[model samples]
Target: MSLESHRAACAALTLLVACGPAMADLQVAVGATSESTVALKVEVDRIVPLASLHPRLELRLATGLLLLSSEEEDGNAAWLLSPALRWTFSGERGAFLEAGIGGALFLETRVDSRELSTAFQFEDRLALGLPWASGELSLALTHYSNAGIKRPNDGLETLTLGYRYPL
Candidate 1:
């Protein structure tokens, strides 16, 4: 994508971030990739359910904007705007399994040695979480890839321990 397009995408995401507070929960997380590249993420998620399979099984549609900055040599950051479908299966107490899938617009195609080849990527996430201290704590693994839409589709994976507090 051109520099102007990236800037325009950023501006649009900024507008969503500004307006997200009225209907969603703000989430901030700090983590690192398997290569030890540090990263910070800011997101907003809303609970939009699709079904209630069981008393403990609930499916939700979460729409959000994620701004991610990582410690790559080039200092390139990514802005991901996508809608995720989350499956929350309750267990003992407040513990649950979190799984989500979505697509993202990766602002930068090259990060370090990975050449994604395209700005569009798919996002998959899995987490084990529990409620604690009026917030939710989770250990999450997230992946980003283009699903072979283009050549040299190198993917990125990140593991993060995060806390989400509803405002």
Candidate 2:
């Protein structure tokens, strides 16, 4: 990653954390990309119930960091912050599905041979979650891309298993 890009991403992440709402959940996840690169994530979900829109629907502001392991040691990482809407099907059971679209800043534009073309990318995610007594267990698939705004937008995808604990 270029020094300027790294600083900008870090600043954005810090702003996300510092200005966040009071109630939130912290989640940690581990997985691998389709190409087998190791991936890890740390995220915070700021819960906001939207009863007016729908009883079962809610809005969440998600902020996080994603780290990817490159096959040939080229840098790999992305920082994301976005808003998501979640719909809970099982009221008391706490089972839900959510999807979100947000912006991401990559640590490196090129991971191995995949040329992302820009440090700024888009983050899209779909997740299924179930909450137990202690916390929540979730399975999520997240994608990062430049949305054809530039050339060589070879996107990145990862499937992850995550654990969320309220803080």
Candidate 3:
């Protein structure tokens, strides 16, 4: 398939997964760094009802944008959509620690007239969350990189506070 077609397909699949059941949890977060760069994210889980991994391991659809970069070579913004798998230490939720790893396709990997070597990258996350009465609050650190698949693999890191509300 053409690159445009592939991007369309990926977007459609992301929407299909993110718009799961009506009862799923939706999370929205905005994060900023000292360098004046910003990141925005929205995420939800697609239920995979497996008895062995139902509550412990969950599939998440994470969509985000990195914008307003301070450095010139980093470009303006990078849009990312990734299907992630999270494994929580506490299987049934509540207070937990989770680790997630996934591959992301970017709308553009070039910034400031420079190419970032690849449009495909890997996303890694680590989070600690506690469920409140109506929602869950999480502190997460995320990283994105090309994994040296191409030259000039400049990686990014963002720390965020996220909230998930049942919808």
The model with the greatest lDDT is 2
In the range 29-131, model 3's lDDT, one tens digit per residue, is 6775334456556565543443575657766655544443445443344455555565556646657666677766655665443445787778788878888
Candidate 2 global lDDT: 0.80
Clash count, one per candidate = 0, 0, 1
TM-score of each: 0.77, 0.85, 0.67
Report how far off residue 143 is in candidate 3 (Å). Answer: 0.9
True-vs-predicted CA distance for residue 97, candidate 1, Å: 0.8
| Global lDDT of model 3 | 0.62
- The positional error of residue 127 in candidate 3, measured at the CA in angstroms, is 1.2
Once all C-alphas are superposed, what RMSD does model 3 give against the true structure?
A: 5.8
Return whichever of 1 and 3 wins on lDDT.
Answer: 1
Q: Which ten residues in a row have the lowest lDDT in candidate 1?
A: 60-69
lDDT value, residue 93 of candidate 2: 50
CA-lDDT, candidates in order: 0.67, 0.80, 0.62
Query: Model 2 RMSD to the real structure?
Result: 2.9
Candidate 2 residue-wise lDDT at 145: 90
Ranking by lDDT: 2, 1, 3
- Model 3: CA > 4 A from native: 1-23, 33-36, 47-93, 111-115
lDDT of 2 by residue, 32-118 (tens): 886788888877777788989889999878778887776577457787786888999978457999899999887778767677899
